[model samples]
Target: MPSSRSAPVARVSQETCNPAVCAPIAEDDKRALVDAVETFIFDCDGVIWKGDSLIEGVPETIAMLRDMGKRLIFVTNNSTKSRAGYLKKFLDLGLEITADEVFSSSFAAAAYLDSIDFPRDKKVYVVGETGILGASSSSHWPPYDRELDGVGIQHLGGESDGDKKVTLASGQLMEHDPDVAAVIVGFDRNVNYYKIQYATLCIRENPGCKFIATNMDAVTHLTDAQEWAGNGSMVGAIKGSTKREPFVVGKPAPFMLDYIANKFGIKKNQICMVGDRLDTDIMFGIDGGLRTLLVLSGVTSETELQSESNSIHPDHYTSKLADLLTVKK
Candidate 1:
């Protein structure tokens, strides 16, 4: 419950709170908007920087908010990076943030397994990057582990499984390990027939094997302003072959929201979620009962926000996260 503001959240929040639809934050409301919340949870890719290029004034704005004694948390659906990996990126971007402040879908995947009391003796077949394995645990990954901590789930597959091939030579059938109790799917740039086929076998053949997805984001950004296939596309392949849906653990799931809220002891009404995507980012905030701000700097466009068919609406709309730079002590 950290705050520099004297009062609580305003009676009027986002456009969704009003009888009418969403509206842009006026020049005068900038200070009021920032003052209303105790914590700010941000979505990384689209809202912070698209690919390598940093959004103008983001670092300054982040520093400004920190100076005001506000709590800041960065959350992302990209499973390619871990908490340690994201911390390095934030520091490189000139933002004074720590790994404890950043949570990614990769971490979420591990967290989800812990929440459900996943058997320590069992193994998770990962179909994403090393981030899901975390740092201390990454090098130790094998097809299965005899023992593991709750957060450090025993996992394999990931980059290790990316290049492995399966050959059904001379009437032989593909085989899979029964210890693989769960298949965690994230964004794997090297997703090949081998990984998909292996994942399908684990989920479909292995009894009680769980299917988990980091996030079902339709598309993601890897390069400057360019969109590429998201983890959802990789997930879809397994879904098609296994005929099973995955338990998602990223944005729009609200698992991370609950984590930070309880850990910080902040109420949902005392927080505001800012992001560029309506589906995952905005929807995530909405589901968790936090105020939502939609920024037009990433996957979402102004046209998409104003689209007549769109049902998801954030509490406020802004050009970018840097817009809050207008607010001061």
Candidate 2:
């Protein structure tokens, strides 16, 4: 197990006793430190930027890593944006990276299903709006012409724009074809009771059918430091009603870990799980048996670390990736 530490060294508690305590890495020393890392996995959104603004020293840190010969990947749980969209965002942020270097929860979900030999030419009902649905279809998941029955009826919550209406239903799915293969859950602003009822029926009828999810992020970040309901909430609704656990394929899941490792032809033990969240990023390492690095640039904090009642801990802790510059010999 990797030891853990609080940012200022004063916040150490039973919660911080997992692995190793990492010393702070300064902005100027990021290169020499990360050069020792074969690969670097970065959490976007809070760590890189919040909304449109880039975090201070991030761009330079990325450049320094590139110069140091470390492979980098943008590991994001945000399924709202497309790969091209995120790639463009990276370029716009002056990172000079490609879409190949980035992985989204949406991508992981789609890729996971594709990796499996799911029967072709069957409809996989999607309980999501555009982003999740669109990403799932990126591999040309075809023969899917209609939405699940009652989907349109149930996807009507929160505020609605005229264009964001559900047009499918569960009854319609059963009407068209009774052999639905899977149910993919994602962010659908227009979800409703009918959609839920129908999804439950589909899962119940076909016990072998898959239930895949893009992510379980409980809160989606808003422009004003606010949080709105996310897919985790939606998944909970179905789980509560149906008593079935949907397979998560994002973040801390081994999907991305395996994907990156295979891409780089490295072992899981050789890579470090670096991110801002303890449950997701750090746990990814703990669950997968890899080292973990928890950064304070995102969701989890020192206060949260000290108060954590669980044994979950990271191998190392730092204020940010840039702080790796202070790693001592």
Superposed model 2: Cα runs more than 4 Å off: 2-35, 135-176, 308-310, 325-329
Model 1 quality (TM-score): 0.89
| lDDT per residue as tens, model 1, 3-94 | 32214645444344232455677755677777777899999887888787688889888989998988999999888877766776777777
Q: Please give the range of 10 consecutive residues that has the lowest summed lDDT in model 1.
A: 141-150
- Using lDDT as the measure, the top candidate is 1
Give the Cα lDDT of each candidate: 0.79, 0.63
Question: Model 1, residue 126: what's the lDDT?
Answer: 82
Each model's TM-score, in the order given? 0.89, 0.77
Error of 2 at 92 (Å): 2.8
